[model samples]
Target: MRSVSIPDAVRCKVAAEPRVDAPHHPITLSFTDGVLTMEGELADLAAKKLALERAASVPGVDHIVDRLRVAPARTMGDAEIRDHVRDLLLEEPVLQPLARATPSLEPGVPLRPDVVLGTIGLSVARGVVTLDGIVPSLAHKRLAGALAWWVPGVRDVVNGLEVVPPEEDDDGEISDAVRLVLEKDPLVDASQLGVSTRRAVVTLSGVVRCGVERRAAERDAWCVFGVDGVTNHIEVRE
Candidate 1:
């Protein structure tokens, strides 16, 4: 028979995973005679369901004794949960635009006066923000809403952001712009793709066969407008 001992570092790592704010029951870890047992109460149903999963994720635990119970839902109302979520949502960068726009969501659009936030194109009216233009994903839309609500004068967010796929034309522009970048550097094959730019947004397309080539194309696009950023949709093929 073999005996096993738990290291303090490993124990500390486990404790840190579920923050103290998380509902937790007693958790016991033992490694004697080659066996490990874990017991704990989790904050709620979700935590209890996830306890075994968390245990399995740890590296050296060979066995577990999961007797953790899922506590009933806390008395805190839905409004409280929503408030907490709202605070968290406002903390993200993507949502900040919404907060800036919220005051002008109506009344023919109050122009965003700040250039940095204005680049995102936020408008406010009355007390809500009416979002416009394109967003890459649903996540951005939600962030916009959170930001609108976070503003002092904001009442709500009007999400008008359209989810559009990066345009094929944009790809062509990207490729061409990348080609230009390569040409200027004298270190890359500039003829591989046709690239172009609009409003500091570089678009790339065409065939880049390797990761290195693709990255190079992207780097070129980025150099043109250091602050505006690049969109690389170059296809990789052999």
Candidate 2:
């Protein structure tokens, strides 16, 4: 297929999204073979996600390669920031219940102390937050990571929480779940895309009209119960 030159209207469309902070960082957009690449820095993850969403909404954009970085406006000492994050975790409504669960220990059976979401551990160095331990579900893990990022001085978050659900689904089940989600999502047309899974990794391929559908498909796949990774290979045919 011959690649179309990126339209100036598309570039204008992306640049016109509402800015998140006072001094907006520029996002450089480039196109090749219908894939639009967004590169540069933004104030935070929210802004980055918004930028990508805007890019996807453009009429002819197919796939988007996001290489945006998040840079916080201010910095705080590691100790103070760590304390703040710890308090946030302790106070989070969803995590409070999990935090209150008692650790179980049985004699002659090794105690897996790190098996609960409440046992999340946090450490900070040079503004980076490292979260480690176990969570009951992927939602809890994401909550911990989001809390870390929400802290004032956090530069980056390393979420190492392990999800140990009571039962695990096989690859086929995971694939089916992702496909169903894509089919149901208003933003994505599943008939125009392909979904496959192996070892919990999902690969989305085929063609879509714009970037939003492509990203919406990937986001839905990631939200599935057992998806560990998503490899989106869908092409934009617009």
The most accurate candidate by TM-score is: 2
| Candidate 1 residue spans exceeding 4 A from truth | 1-179, 225-227
The 0-to-1 C-alpha lDDT of every candidate, in the order given, reads 0.47, 0.67
TM, every model: 0.25, 0.42
Whose lDDT is greatest here?
2
Worst 10 residues of 2 by lDDT: 105-114
What lDDT does candidate 2 reach at residue 229?
63
Residue range 1-238, candidate 1, lDDT tens digits = 8543353433554566563223235565656553556555555333333444455556676666544443323433323333333443445565555434344433455333311232244444433345566666444543444344333344334556654664333444443434534554433466676565664455666776687877766644543311143556778786
Clash counts for the predictions, in order: 22, 1
Worst 10 residues of 1 by lDDT: 110-119
